[model samples]
Structures are given as structure tokens and as C-alpha cells.
Target: MASSPTELPIHRFNSFDGVELAYREMGEGRPLVLIHGYFSTAMVNWVRYGHAGKIADRGYRVIMPDLRGHGDSARPHDPAAYPHDALADDGFALIEHLGLTDYDLGGYSLGGRTAMRMLARGAKPGRAIVAGMGLDGILNTAGRGGYFRRVLTNLGSFERGTPEWLTEAFLKTVQGDPVALLNVLDTFADTPREAVEAIAMPVLIVAGKDDDDNGSAEALADLLPHGRHGVIPGNHMSAVTRPELGIAIAEFLSE
Candidate 1:
């Protein structure tokens, strides 16, 4: 029996470190694990904009996981909970837990960086999509992570209409835990240039034409042995909301 698109049930699993993590699934077919961006949950990044359904309808088992500090996943205030490459660690655990020997993986923004780390760390997916991420974003996460650290540390200090203020507003909307999120920042580690160059799998470096929040998407794609760049309609924030993002992903995967 085929599952309804709306019936996204959150499933819980214990990661390697015994911290409980959560994920949601849709459709039924080859697995496609999607990691949502920072400050956003699986629902917000993949489901809210219909990206998951769009891909799932094309015959994929869309697995969306809320990272350790975000969404329904357990948020641990203890700094020890988030070791180096924490997100990638959880991602590896998810793949192992699901017994997925053959699967597809992709992520957006922070999630995208996580995907890169996962690949560098050797979790091979049939095809990988690094959306809304660039070479600099993956190679030097502190600059971006620092921006969020500021937002989390000084929530009320931002004035209206500023980027910092907007980030705070989004954090408030999501009810993100500042303490845990700060720890998540500690999980950020720079990916080596050789590691990025060594990824042999076909990769789609999709990004919004107006989005250069991290760095140059094309440059990142150029570095990969089998990387291809796909352009979508909007900026980083707005691009995920557009149908073009999913369309690009689905098309790339189909090819």
C-alpha cells in the first residue's frame, strides 16, 4: 500500500552516543535522506515547501531527519554531546540504523555542509546534492557559524530589518534552543580541499542564483570530480521555498 503524502510520522532512534534523534518519512521506494538547513526542521526545509513530496512522488522514500539540536531531535545542553563533526556522526548513525547500503543523500545550507562532511567521512550515496552551499562554506564554517553564535548569544540585541534581527525572528519562530544550537556550532569543522576534490560520486551543486551566503557554488562544483551546478530561482532563504529547488533536485537524481 502506498503511503499518503500527509502522513509523515516522526520516528525516533538512539544515535551512537545514546542521544535520541528523530526523523520523518514519506513515500516508498529507494531511500533519499535529506538533512534540513540550520535553524530549520525537516518539516520546514523539506516538507513545508513541498520539496519532499515533489521528490517522493517521483518514487523515492524521502527520509528527513531533524539534526540533534533542531526539530524533534533531542537537544542536549552538555557540550560533550556535540563532538567534532557531530551532524555527520548522526547522519552516519541514521544510515546505519536504517540499514541503508544503497541510498541518496542531500542537504541544504548547514545540512548541505553536513552532507559534504558525510561524503568526506565516507558515507557513500548513489548521488549527492549539496544545495545552498559553497566551497568556502564547507572549508570554513566558523565564519557562518560565528554569525549564528552571535544571533544565539544576543537574541534581543538586533534591530528590525537587519539580517541578524531576521535570523533571531526565524529562531523564535522555530523555538530553537540557543544553548544546544551554540553547541551545534562547535560541531562545525572545515572540510579539507583534498577531501572535496576526492569525492568521486556525481554531485549536483544546486544553489539559488541570488544566493552567495557562503561562497561560490560554481567554484565548489568545479572542485568536485563529478560535480554539476544547478541554478534555481531564489536566494538561499527563498530558494528552498520555490518549486524550482525540488525540480532541480528531482531532475538531477533522475539523470
Candidate 2:
């Protein structure tokens, strides 16, 4: 059963770099950190999707952080500033800041990529879940190239109004500075494929049947040392929104 929103506790902490990081904490057992995907905030990705409360109800202290440059965190304008290592550092700093050890970490899309980077850097979690992501950090590189081109071409339309969910999501996030989006793209470009294979911890890889952007979950599952793959029946957004995904995640972490 899902816990009510009013029952959860939300807190904010400052990262080493001075960015204010916000996280939602709930439940009363093992600690788990939930990271959001690219262009999405923790509130939208986890709270709105019912992931925070759902996971909390299963006897785990769930922490959902708003990554730097997204959500309520500080947004630096330099494109070169948002490297994967820096992102990993932020994760570690948050864990250390909270004095947490042997906790679980989970992420989706860009967040998943960051979690893998953290593992490669020796930040060990009891278990990890990487959803809507693949071994290759780049989400459909060949396709993304063209897709980004279209995004750039249709910037005017997006700026005006496009009812397409993905487009609207992108537009909603890409505001303030196009450089931040480009920085994210460049950061993903530098993600090492070997990092996925280097992760020594047990991991759950979840993907939507229609999540063509990140490749299939099976592809991601094959990269982990110990990985379990599952497919939800929806596109990327819906996959995260559905309750089954949260239940599967909580069950996997419990094991």
C-alpha cells in the first residue's frame, strides 16, 4: 500500500559546491537514495510518481535528491562544470553529509548513469537499481543526434507550445540556458562503457517496452556483474509513473 504524502518528510542540505540539495525521507529501516532522470526534478520523478512514499512503506528510508542543475538545486552555467565525476562527487558528498553507509541507491536515465559512475568510483551501496538506462551511457547516440537536431530546429515551436509530453518535458527543463542541456549531453558523451561492467554490486535494471531512447533493459542487464532485468508496459515516462515499477524496485532491494 502507498503511504500518504503528508506522512513523508522532506529535507534540504547544501552540497560541497554550495548547491542546495533537496531529498525526501520516509520509512524506518535501511536507507535508500532515489535519483531522478535528466530534465526532471525529484518531486516530479519520485514524489509525483509515488516512488518515495511507496518505497518508504516497504520498510526503507528513501532519500530522493534533486541533482545539481535540476529542480531546486543550484544551476551553474558553465558547460564544462557538470561532469559525471562531479555528479558522482555530489552523490558521495550527500551520502557522507548524511552519515549514511551501506545504503541502497537507485536512479533513472541520467540518474542511473550517475549511480553507475559512483559505483565505479568505489561508492558501494548494499544494492542498486538502474532504470531506463543501458550499458552505453549515451541514449541512442545516432538517433539522439538527429533528435537533438529536431529539438533545435523546433525550439521555436517548443518555446511556443507543443502538447507532446516528451517535447514539453524537454522544453520545461531546457529553459534558462541551452548550455546546461549541452553540458549534460557532453557529460554523457564522456561516460565510459566499461564503468557499467565494473560495477561489482547487485543491480536491478528496469526498462519500458517502449523505452527506445535508452535501449532495452536486457542490454543494460548484460553489463552488470549481478543484474536482474524487468520490463514495464509503457513508454519512459509512464514506466516511471506506474506503481508496479516502485513495487518491483522495493521487492528487489528487500532481497
Candidate 3:
């Protein structure tokens, strides 16, 4: 039988680089730390999507944290404030702060990339799920960096029928600090293909069926030592909210 941990009040801890991070914990069993995507908070990625509650019901203590520059965490707009693998370092810091040895980790989009880089940096979990990223996405950072930069600086007008136009419209709706997010672009990780392929941890790769912005999740899984792929029904923006996404993650982590 799985056990539940007592709910703790909001906690604040300094990340590896001294940046303050905010996190909340619920239920209990094995610890599962979930990272939200860029421009989104833990609340949006897990709580609103039902992943946190569903996972908690499954008897896992869910640890959801706002990444360094997003949500309730400290948001620094200076590019120098953002550093390599900064978010990953925050995740690891939370693990150590809570003294967790046995746990699972998962993240959506930017969060997933952070988790992958954490693994690349020797942070190990019982299992990992990289959601919303693919092979080409992780290997190539130049284009993404550029897109985000434009998303931060240019609100003028994206030419119709262009990716920039579509993305700008989405970014406009998200309640995130644009300047801080811009700095994040300057600091986003460019993890090597070899580093990703070398990860020996069992990983479940989840992506939307129609999300081509990133590479293929299935193809990326093939490159991993113990990777598998699952698809939810929507495009990138909507897939994270689908019930299937939570179900797949809970089932995968349970195994």
C-alpha cells in the first residue's frame, strides 16, 4: 500500500546559486518532483492540468516548484543572473534540502529539458519523464533561442502564417515576466546529443501527436538507454492539459 505524507506549508529554499525558489508539497508515498515549462508556473503545469492532484491520489508526494524566474520564485531580468543548468540546479537543491534519496522527476517543455540536463549532470531518479521535447529540439538551441528572443523583444507584428506570429499570440496570454524570460533564453541549455543518449535512467518521453515544434518524442526515446514514448491527443499547447497526459505519467512512474 502507498502512504501519504503530511501536507507542508509553502517553503522557500535557496537554489545552488543562491536564487530563492518556492515549492509546495502534497500527499505522500515516493517523492515525485515536477517542473513546469517556461513561461508557465507549477500551478499551471501541474495543478491546473490535474497532474499534481492525480499523482497525489496515486500516493506519491508531489513536489511542485516554480522555476527560478517564473511563478512565485525570484525573477531576475539580467542575463548574467541566468546561468547554465540553473533550473536543474534548483531541482537538485530541492531534493537535497528535503533529503530525498528515492524519487521520480518529470517536467514539461522547458522543465523537461531541465530534468534531462539534471540527469546529464548526474542527478538520478527512479524514473524520469521528458514531456514536450524531441531529438532535434534538444540538440539544437540556436533557433529556439532566437524565437524566444523575438518573443521577448518584438511584439510589433509577426507576419501571418509564421511561427513567430503564432508564438507571440500565445506568449501574450501567459502571465510571465517577459524580461526574465528573455534572460532565460540567454541561459537556456544546449545539452549535447551524447549527453542525452548517455543517460541510463529509465525515461518516458511524452509529446503531443501534432507537436512538430520539437523533434519526435519516439525518435528521441530510441536514443535513450531505457526510453519509451507516449502520445496525448492535442498539439503542444493543449496536450499538457489532457487527462491522458497525467494518466500516462502516473502509470509510468508507478512502474
Candidate 4:
């Protein structure tokens, strides 16, 4: 039987920027790195959902990283510390630290955008998966970014039923660092259309049918040189936990 995420041990590493990062490795075979979304830890996004286990059982080694300021990584609240490419840099740095090549890579939401940006920055993975993200969000993060800024700046002070309120609740649910996350929002990556198109790789774009937050996953997939769109059960918040999401990702990477 493949080892479950809970059964796997946690390890730590230092990124190029000197921030401490935590990660977990499970199963053994071809390497696949999965980055957890914003306001989430690797365990919550991948392990709790059984996504990591499912992928590992499919004969692939899974490496799940806790993004800076999330999970067990360092929280740098200084705005200047959070660069546009900081998240992607952490991912590619992890790959380089491991001396890996031709490995599979991807992420969800923030992680998805990071994966896309990493690819644009020349981290060539054998296969790629972008989940819970759309094209426009990657190209122009200002709108969504501004929303987060408002939530954090006011500390989720909006009235109930408002987007700001919901966002703040979600942020609290994950126990995120207020200042650090504010910077994450401020320095979100902006990957241009041309940069995305230059990736001559098999890319899987996973989206929740009801998720219109980032935009349409199908539309984003159409922009890739070799992109395939996948629909999974649940909205952005619930989709990560659905087994269907894991199934789609495994099938795509294995092919």
C-alpha cells in the first residue's frame, strides 16, 4: 500500500531567498511537485483531500510544498520581501535544490498561478497542471489582488454576505499571517499571454464547473500550446477536496 500523507514525515529546506520552507514527500516513482493554494498548507490542500495519496498511488513520487507565509514556512510581512515571482521562485528553487529534471509540476489557485509563472520563468517540467485558476487572473492580478488588499487592510471588516467578509473568513479559517498575506496579495505574479504561450508542454488546466473567480479554465487551456481543460466537482473552496479533482490530475499527468 502507498503511504498516506499523514504517515509521511515532514522535511525542511531553504529557498534561494533564505526563507525556510516545509515539504512532504510520498510514494516513489516519477517525481511530481504539488504546490498548495493560498491561505492553505500542503497538508490541508493535498493530503487532507487525498489528492497527494491518489497521485502517489498512481506510481508517482509526490512532493508537496508549504508556500512561504503559509503552512510551516517563514512569514515575511515586509512588502518589499514579497516579489511578484517570489512564490514561483520558491518552487523552482525547491526543484533545483533536489537536482531534479523533467519532473511533473503544478498547483491550485495561487499555486496554479505560481506553477504557470514558474514555467514562464524557464522551469521546464515534463507535465504541468494548473487547477482552480483562470487566464485573466494570471495576466492581470490587480483586481483580485486589490480585493485581498482590502480584506487584509481592513482585516476582513466587511459586512456579512460581502466578498470581503467571505474572504476574511476564509483567511481566518486557514490561520494566515495578516501582514505576510497582504504582501502576497500585493506582489502577486503577472504572467503575460506570450510567456504562457511559449510553454511547449502538456498542460492540464483544472477548474471547478461553478468557479468563475479567476475566469474560465477552458478559456485558459485554449491559450496554451498543448493545454487540456478539465472540469471537476465543487466550487473553488470545495473543489480541492473532491476526489474527481485528483482523478483528473492523475490521469492527465500519467498520460
lDDT of each: 0.92, 0.73, 0.83, 0.86
Can you write out model 4's per-residue Cα lDDT over 1-255, one digit (the tens) per residue?
334456678788999878888888888899999998888889889888788888988999999999988878888777777776788888988998888986999999999999998999988899999999998888988877876777788974689978778878878788888888877775587888999889998999998989888888888899998999999888988898899988999999777
For model 4, state the Cα shift of residue 89 in Å: 1.1
Q: Which candidate leads the pack in TM-score?
A: 1
lDDT of model number 2: 0.73
lDDT of 2 at 147: 55
- lDDT per residue as tens, model 2, 35-130: 888777777777777777778878888888877777666667786566645677788889998999779998987788778777777888989988
Question: Candidate 4: where is the Cα deviation over 4 Å?
Answer: 1-4
Q: For residues 136-181, what per-residue lDDT tens digits would candidate 1 score against the true structure?
A: 9999998898889888889899899999999888898899998999
**Model 3 clash number:** 1
> How does model 1 score by TM-score?
0.97
* C-alpha root-mean-square deviation, each candidate: 1.2, 3.7, 3.3, 1.7
Give me candidate 2's TM-score against the actual structure: 0.83
Clashes of each: 0, 0, 1, 0
Give lDDT for model 1.
0.92
lDDT of 3 by residue, 63-119 (tens): 989988888899987777888767777888999999989899999998888888889
Candidate 1: Cα lDDT at 4: 53
| Number of the top lDDT candidate | 1
